[model samples]
Target: MAKPVADTFSPSENAAGYVSDDNPVLGFSHMHDSGTGGLPSLGNFPLFVHPGCPGDDFTRCAYSLTFRTTSRVPGSVTAAPGYFAVNLTNSVRAEMTATQHAVLYRFGFSGDEHVDVLRDLKRPDEVEKGVPYSPLVLVDLVDLMNSRSLGGILVSPETGRVMGEGRYLPSFGSGKYDAFFCADFKGAAIRKTGTFVGNDAAENPKILDGVGSGFHIPGGSAGAWLQFERPTNNSLLARVGVSFISIEQACENAEKEIADWHFERVESDARKQWREKLGVIEVDPTGVSEELQTTFWSGLYRTLLSPQNYTGENPLWNSTEPYFDSFYCIWDSFRAQHPLLTIIDPIAQTDMVRALLDIYRHEGKLPDCRMAFCKGFTQGGSNADVVIVDTFVKKLTAGIDWDTAYEAVVSDAEVEPPNWGLEGRGNLVSWHSLGYIPWDDTDLNGTGPMSRTISRGVEYAYEDFCIATLAEALGHAEDAAKYRRRGGNWRNYWNSDQRDVFQDPNDVTVQTDYTGFMQPRLVNGTFRYHNTRACSPVQEMHRCYYDTHLDTYEGSPWLYSFYVPQDMATLIQLMGGPAAFVDRLRFFHTSGIAYMGNEQGFLPVFQFHYAGRPGLSAYFVREYIPALFNASVNGIPGNDDCAMGAFSAFAMMGFFPVAGQDVYLLSTPFFPEVRIRARTEGKWSVIKVWGFDPEGKKKYIQRAKLNGRMYTKNWITHDFFLKGGTLELWVGEEEGTWGTKEADLPPSWPVEWADGGGVGLDDKF
Candidate 1:
């Protein structure tokens, strides 16, 4: 829960992307959202450390973020799973760790003896022996974006305890939220206490309350400070508890969770929690490189960093149901991250599903993205439908209210909210009538950005398909048939005449062999011409964000066209049978069109499995693993959004999930053996490779045996994990015929749409 603090040298307060090596040290805050794009989220109430202002003068202390910013000692930054440490040029070293709702920091003040001697020599009268070492730490009332609207801080003069609350805007959504913090210090006596506004700090006023205008001066800083006497061991310990409820609750949360004031104990507890969460899946790692292992574990670590557990901290409504925030965006996580969690951490997944249903119970619509107790902008479809159905298909039914879950997803399909950009689906009337979101469809029911026609059309189709899966399970036959037909709406956006052409840097246009893509259609039922490669990395990469008028969201038609996950059988046929489809898919990857950075690029990496080329799927998994996803700082190609790590972990573990479905496409694992402890039966499901290759060759799967029987299917079901078994794969240097037969392919929607409605895959797997 403790966020590392740094002051950006760039123009904006949140520039340099959270914490950077170039930015100076700003102090540690108690809350943050990791691996998210857009403006920064929740770096509020940061507490800065100063090793006693020069000459023991209170005014000499740097109270503002600008004046207090100190360069970090080069190469001194160190971080681990639950711990972080860094040395500053001010001769102060800061180390921190955290509990669920509280953070414990140990600030060490090791004065530079040589610099002290030089100061004494230069001014003998002002500094008799050496500079005083009284440490002064302050808690600022500002956030990462300085978007504070109303804030107040109160410092206890005798105890040096600071309590504050502020209403600030969410990083990526509309409206504001209230956050509170309580900070207490140990290892030092309170010498004095006061409040500061900007650089002017005084000891007279111990309480400050103001609106946004009052704190908008020079540095946009206002907070309370506690000056302490020189510690007996030159170190001070500060514990901060944060909550969305109230300052009293924040203090209670801190005192209840971290009453011992033991930094090592807190750090140890944090590490233990992480180990328990990540230890369910164990890899042998015998044939894996250290870099690949680091990539796998680090990616796994990132997957758990968000959708933070704010069960009781939610102040918007009181409910006994579990509440989780920082979904960040379900559009990103529903593809992989939530699926990964459904496998390894089903308990958390169950809680998240319950939380979504609870949100729908109060908010009237399932959120597409949510954080800071506020609604975030919906990136594409109501993808939370995918998350709920994925969990239901995997059978994570402990405390899940399936009745409410079905109602929520049906609301997304049949009803339109007033503001569809933040929650639920837009253009519902057209989605129901025209089978696609037209580029210029006029929506009278609700308002939102009239963009992402192609991307949203495919995503909404898949979402409806997911709802169909749940409806069939819950015995809602009519609802099941209706949504299942709507699931085929992706076929409406298919412009058969659309041709893809590439333009070089010299402005020469060259047509390609591939034809037909999901193009934007106008309200008049005529397809509008949109470049097939417009939003791809090789073309206008920045054209498809939240506010863009582009037809796709963060992807090209080439990528979205392959996003027909619910009906890959038809998609493969439309792209020209298996041979042509394989050729086009290979060209999409080998050419510069495919980018592994965005989450949309993830599924296509393994789409070859649908074409009966499971070997090529294995080939591309190796291609992107250590290439785009690795162990370096810039390892992830794009905004992680927690999905990058999920993609890497699933790829390295020898299987990739088709989200919202029960299918897991099989491949050769990077490790010799991978065992996952199933949450259902509490038994281990093992994937063991026979011919292990440490030199990185022999990745193609030649044959496979499940529970000592011949298994030729290219995909496995969630039941394989629910009921434990051993899946043994023998590898060779080339593709083999084990899972190449047409019947061995993963289950797909029928090619022919029947009026009575095609049967869902619920009973097939």
Candidate 2:
């Protein structure tokens, strides 16, 4: 039976790639998502080692038929940031490392006269033989984002070298494009080169067809292979180059990246590069365990995996500007990951905005859930708007062309694209016309996917606020005023009758009821009622609601009720005030409705800060440390989609970002000291954080100091961190209640700000 694998070491396979301690070894694959929540996207171009069995043809044998590797012993498989290694049961050891666009493979054979290097080429919906590979490499074009290959090719230019180009469609996208590769062999004692097809072996066919079947036959299993004689040092090496443009570019990239066969030098250089990037933030590891250190460091490592650099890889019109892809959706990442970059790596963030602009220039809109070379689904709003505005508000928009960006943002808000599935907002008209999306009216309207109308309403509200915030920052007062009114649309969904039930307040049970909360509204301005509780079982909720999708894009209505960050003060009043807001915040955890694993409900943990309960926020954040996350392969709670790594990183670093704002809410970090070389404007500013929790019992911030002076507030502003200085916090076990006062609270949109452009049902109808 085909059982699922847990990629404890290789998180890149995302949720699907797991090589468990108990499971037999499946060869390592290149190209994978670190911790994404969807179906595994890339496991292409795998490299494995095989033993010499009776009747085993190195060039013809299937990869799975080979003997599975023995259990990995400690130090037997060494996987660092840019490197990996494993020893097979056949006494064959394989070590691999990577550059930005290339990977190097080194194989060692122990008690053998000869050994086989294996690769099983897979193409979507084709016979295994149809998947082509030269003596060089294979371009499995049909094998893409859970989709089939439209077409692809493999080419062998000469002995010891291979190149290929292919195209495939994404599983979740609406477009297709080609990818290319070039690989070269070195230090291997090659005795012969041959081809394998359905347990049959044939001599090497020296073919170089970039458009035709290079070497693959019509049906059955097939791949190219090489039998190596016993080496001088019992080892051999291979280098593979990858590009999205063309074969020539792939070859050039390979040549430019790893010219010489210095494996150790390449490995050392890769580790150095990782060190430099990860060095942006430093936490003292004096009191933490090795596991905690691993969790912290690996969490940071996952953060760097995506928004991959496709700078010279765009197959479209040529330009000097940078291009990036692999945005599963901005909804997942813009929350914490991108915001964390502003502190750790702002240049990358600035370039990311530039890349978004370039994508807008070409695709006519910024990418939403983009996968390899194609556009995917839009989850909530045009969340890229929030990402751009978040960076802009934080003064991290250094090299971005704000004027061009403004025009694009305006276009997204003002005009509805023809295909709502592909780009721009098709629901803007309805949202503006009715001031909210009506659940029953969706059938009568030509707007967005109606499955999560309430969720979309809230997301659009925040996104509009983001756009408005940017407009105001850029001095477009009229546009800002228009969007600010639109941003208040979230108010329309508040069903005043729904109230939360804390079953047993004194006990810590995982059950709370948001029976009275944000409910869907009908076209007649009446609330659409449902009988199921927010925490109801999935089947139960589905049975109760008719034709309407109850879940709100990985969250619940009660979870999203407090999502009114644009005007939290009003939301607080609506929820009955600070104490009630804190109770509702607790209700998320007690009721088990809080989606702490993903970004949708990430803000609620910090919402306690806004509710004048900084200590509770700190308490919950600290509780999440050992329960929800770890350093193991499955350490990630859910899809490390986009910026999910930032979630962990933020918690460990003792803060959380309120998206679309320039502030970071406070908490007590796990470490004694944390330091960041924050980049702002055109200079580097050092921001330092110190925690005085030596005994480790203290989890709440009792008091704080900024630049040697007493700091009253529980949060830090972007400007405060931009012009960096020391931030010291004295922590304790009990609730401090110091920041609960109104004057000490973080900035929230006042109810008066929405007076002129109110969006209640009465105002529109």
Judged by TM-score, which candidate is best?
1
Number of colliding residue pairs in each model: 0, 14
How do the residues 314-354 of candidate 2 rate in per-residue lDDT, one tens digit apiece? 77768778887777667789888888877777888888889
lDDT of each: 0.85, 0.65
Q: Over the stretch 239-309, how does candidate 1's per-residue lDDT look in tens digits?
A: 99999999999999999989999989988998998899998899997857899999999999999987999
Per-model TM-score on C-alpha atoms: 0.95, 0.87
Worst 10 residues of 2 by lDDT: 1-10
TM-score of 2: 0.87
Our tally of clashes for model 2 stands at: 14
Report the C-alpha displacement of residue 183, candidate 2, in angstroms.
Answer: 1.5
